[model samples]
Target: MKQQLVFATNNPHKVAEIQQQLGDRYAFLSLQDIGCTAEIPETGRTLEENARLKARYVVDHHGRDCFSEDTGLEVYALEGAPGVDTAHYAGPQRNAKENNDKLLSALGDRKDRLACFRTVICLVQNGQEYFFEGKCDGRIATYPTGDGGFGYDPVFIPDEGNGRSFSQMSTEEKIAISHRSRAMVQLEAHLKKQSDVARPTA
Candidate 1:
């Protein structure tokens, strides 16, 4: 029998991406499937804390396996102003364009162009918690490039992936080198180990 996993997220886009990454090995369910309507408050001070909180919350409430992730953009030039508040960097409304523009403006006349994206995945199984982290370093472009990605993807030029920013690459390409993807690789390893331990011996 397959194990059930809950993805602690309400965003349709995030849910879809995670599903593709994790594949069919596990039975993944979104928050909607578990009848979770209460707002998951992000009171944590950092991405690592937030990710763990979400995963543990869902698992405790639903009594099932669950996972969650928190990602953030840290601009070296801006002293990481949006390090922990990438979700609402611009304002409470969460306008992607506005957030991008605000960051660009704050970085006026800065030639450093150094930045990084950090992602942390938190896993909760039977009340046990685990964490994995991944980082992608790159330079921020002076202007937006492609329209493929949402939020600040147009302005984030990854260290490798392609000449253009993440917004220019397809989903497959993005996942190949994304910070989240790296973290997911670690997560996959963790799950594989669990599967081995749970397997019956001859």
Candidate 2:
């Protein structure tokens, strides 16, 4: 039987991406699946803090083993101005196009386009918390491209993507080298170790 785990998110798309990454090693549940309707607060100053806040909320309120992740597109030129505020970078509305536009405008003709996508995942199990982090180094494009991804995907090109933005690639291609995928890999390894420890030695 697969170990059941709760992922602190209501978006089925996000859950699906993770399921694809982790395979059938575990049965993943979303916030809706666990009947959690409360909007978990993410009032943290950093990616790790935000992830921890969400994961801790689930453990405290729902009493479940849950995990949450926070991702940010940090640009070297911008000095990571929107690290924790990646979602609402443009305004309180959290408009993706506006945010991308703001990013591009701020970067206006700057020679340095170096950036990286970072993801921090916080896992709360049995009342204990653990963190896993991953980063994908890349650079921002001069203009937005592609129509397949959301947020900064259209303007960010991975170092290994052969000059193509994430939005230009298929879902499988993006996840294969995404920051979230790297973090998930670590989380899966940790869980596997714990499972092995819990298994009976016949």
> Best TM-score goes to which candidate?
2
Model 2 C-alpha lDDT per residue in residues 25-72, reported as the tens digit of each score: 889988888899997888999999999999988888888989999999
* Model 1 lDDT per residue over 1-202, tens place: 6667788888776766667777787777888889998788788999999998888788778777888999999998788868889989999888989999988898987899899999999998767888999999997888999878677899999989656799999888888888888998898899899889998999
Quote model 1's TM-score. Answer: 0.94
Cα misplacement distance, residue 105 of candidate 1 (Å)? 1.1
The local lDDT score (0 to 100) that residue 98 gets in candidate 1 is 94
Q: Candidate 1: where is the Cα deviation over 4 Å?
A: none
Q: How close is each model in CA RMSD to the real structure?
A: 1.4, 1.2
**Could you tell me which residue pairs clash in candidate 1?**
none
Clashing pairs in 2: none
How far off is residue 56 in model 1, in Å? 2.0
Residues forming the 10-long window of minimal summed lDDT in candidate 1: 13-22
